[model samples]
Target: MYSVVILANGLFPSTEKPLELLSQADKVVCCDGAAAKLLMWGREPDLIVGDMDSLSDSLKKRYSNIIKKCDGQEDNDLSKAFRSCLDYHPSSIHILGATGIREDHTLANVSLLAEYTELLKDIDCTVDIMTDSGVFYSGFESMQSYECKEGAEVSIFAFDNTLKMTCEGLKYQTDHVIFDSLWKASLNMAKSSKFVLKLNHPAKVIVFICND
Candidate 1:
């Protein structure tokens, strides 16, 4: 089962999808201000992690037992919440509300997914960011494949300084190419039911399947 983490950003998908995810989550963690959103939706988080700057005083008093404060200013609330989830040793993690509102924050949050993936590599824990537009998966130093309908839109980018990759089953196939810029692999489409990517080093890959 997956552990769900909700960030403070206000870019969650429709209510139905998040509720569905909550229902299936083995544990739910809220990052600081996100607790207020969960409370508004009539759900109590299993744990709340952050610097306590965004959490209201009343809510803090009310949910004191579940609140775990991480006052490190170096990392954002999302990173704090992620560290807290390590205690539960979840099989995988699904992130919500990580985008939207502030474009700078959105990019920063999305960029951190690769670093988080590298941190969890030894434990074999997968991390994904879920948004209304699509889902982003983080992969490192391995071969990975995804199942998607033919003609689906897919994008892959390098998170590190450089990414060495080879792929098949995409509209524009790549054979052992090194990508240095994020835009190098954008706007690709799936050519078959499945697509495969072989990575020579740690990297971040994002696939966007048409919601329709």
Candidate 2:
């Protein structure tokens, strides 16, 4: 499927979920310092993208041929690595190590998922943030359903100022409601094997589903 996994320099994935993501990845791209952890794990990334400030000198030299220096302060290392993935025209992109450690960094990184999704909408590429605890999906206007284990924790966040949403198969169901805040939907439980979310109009939203 030409699935690519982008590794960020946040918290390293400690569970099987992240490892499963790596196993399904056709290519793994590390973001700057994240390559260090990948190296420690004895996994070599197909490409490395970032400012190179956090990358050690030895590692940089060793992977010089695959390193793509994007020394721009406007975009973080993760964003740079993500943009680089577009060149490959991947069918899907799974992001790992994008959360954990610094709370502010983690939030910012997660928020970027929407921006990346917007950029790839025309190409019909899917992007999801896979953390140690769960997976985060970004979607804009339309109905989406995800399969989850019964009783799994599911949270939805509005990335935009306003979103009209409806949900089913969750402990808390919303019926054609409008949300203006980012925390409008949070801490809901799955009631069945799957849950569905329907949105009206084009707007960014994040769906976080806990690992079984």
Candidate 3:
């Protein structure tokens, strides 16, 4: 399968898992300032995408051939890089450097995972946001199972507070809980090697599983 990795302008990953994935990606796409980070790490980006506002003139001139300038106010640089990845028709897309440093940007990028899931569902492409702490996945309201290490941290978030859900293999049961607040069902732990989530209706939800 064609796998693509997108590096954003957030904190550059220094952890082992994110770094390994970045180094192993078939194609590494950078978003404006992230191009400089990739180069400093001794790896060249296959494609640099953004509005060109964050990049320096010398770096732009040096990598002009590989840069894709997307000047639009509607989407951020990370979004532009993701849209560009669609042209490659990759089977899977992994996003890194999308969290930390700025709290606002981190939250926005995390929420975009849900939007990306909606956009790529029909195309059968998997998208994930990998952070220094964990990995983020967006899915619809359904019975979803995730294989993870025992005692791993798990958190679920949804835009609709009325949405009810249940889970198996979690330290705390979620059947009787109302998701009125974003932190209502956070900081959960897995009791087994895998956990299952059963949603009450068809709605989008974001799940985060920390690295083992």
Candidate 4:
């Protein structure tokens, strides 16, 4: 399976898990200013995407051949980087440096996970946003299963509040919960090493699995 890593210009990753993923990625794509951070970390990205505004002139000149100028103002740098990765036809995409620093930016980046999953639904590609504290996954299918550790922290957010869901292996049951609120089923814990989420219909859900 082909794996692609998209490094955004958020807080630079310092944790071992994210660093390990970056190092092992089949191809690494940097979002504008993130290229400098990746270079500082002593790794090079296969491609640098997004508008050239945040990149240094010297670095741009040096990596001109690998630099892809995406001048779309509608999409964020991370989105641009993600779209660029699709050309490589990756089976899995891991997003790093997507969270931390500004809370607004962090929230925006996390919410995009649902959109990314929808865009890749027909392609059968998995997408994840890895942070220092945890990893975020978006589910578009009716049912989804996740491997977890007993008592591990878990948070579930429904992109479509009207969507009903029932879950198994979670400390708190979501069968009777109303998802109109973002935190309606959040801060839950896993009761076992595996959990399953079954939705009433097709909907989008974002699941956060903590590293601890």
Give TM per candidate.
Answer: 0.88, 0.92, 0.96, 0.95
- Each prediction's whole-model lDDT (CA): 0.77, 0.87, 0.91, 0.91
lDDT of 2 by residue, 1-212 (tens): 79999999988888998988887788999999999998888788999999999999999999999999987689899999998988888999999999998999989988899899888879968999999889998877588778889999998988554566788899987664456665678889999998888877677788899887
Ten consecutive residues with minimal summed lDDT in candidate 1?
Answer: 203-212
Q: Clashes in each model (backbone N, CA, C under 3 Å)?
A: 0, 0, 0, 0
Worst 10 residues of 3 by lDDT: 139-148
TM-score of 1: 0.88
Write out the backbone clash pairs for model 4. none
lDDT of model 1 at position 90: 86
User: Residues 17-99, candidate 4, lDDT per residue (tens digit)?
Assistant: 99899988999999988899999999987999999898999999999999999896698988989998999999999999998
Model 2 scores a C-alpha lDDT of: 0.87
In candidate 4 the C-alpha lDDT for residue 204 amounts to 82
Ranking by TM-score: 3, 4, 2, 1
Candidate 3, residues 1-212: lDDT per residue as tens digits? 88899999999999999999898888999999899999999999999999888899999999999999999799999899999988888999999999998999999999999999889978978999999899999887477778789999999888887788989999999988787777988999999999989988877888899998
- The residue-by-residue lDDT of candidate 1 on 41-110, one tens digit each, is 7777899988888889999999899999998779998988888898988888888888888888888887
Clashes of 4: 0
Which stretches in model 2 have alpha-carbon errors above 4 Å?
Answer: 176-180
TM-score winner:
3
Model 3: pairs clashing at backbone N, Cα or C within 3 Å? none
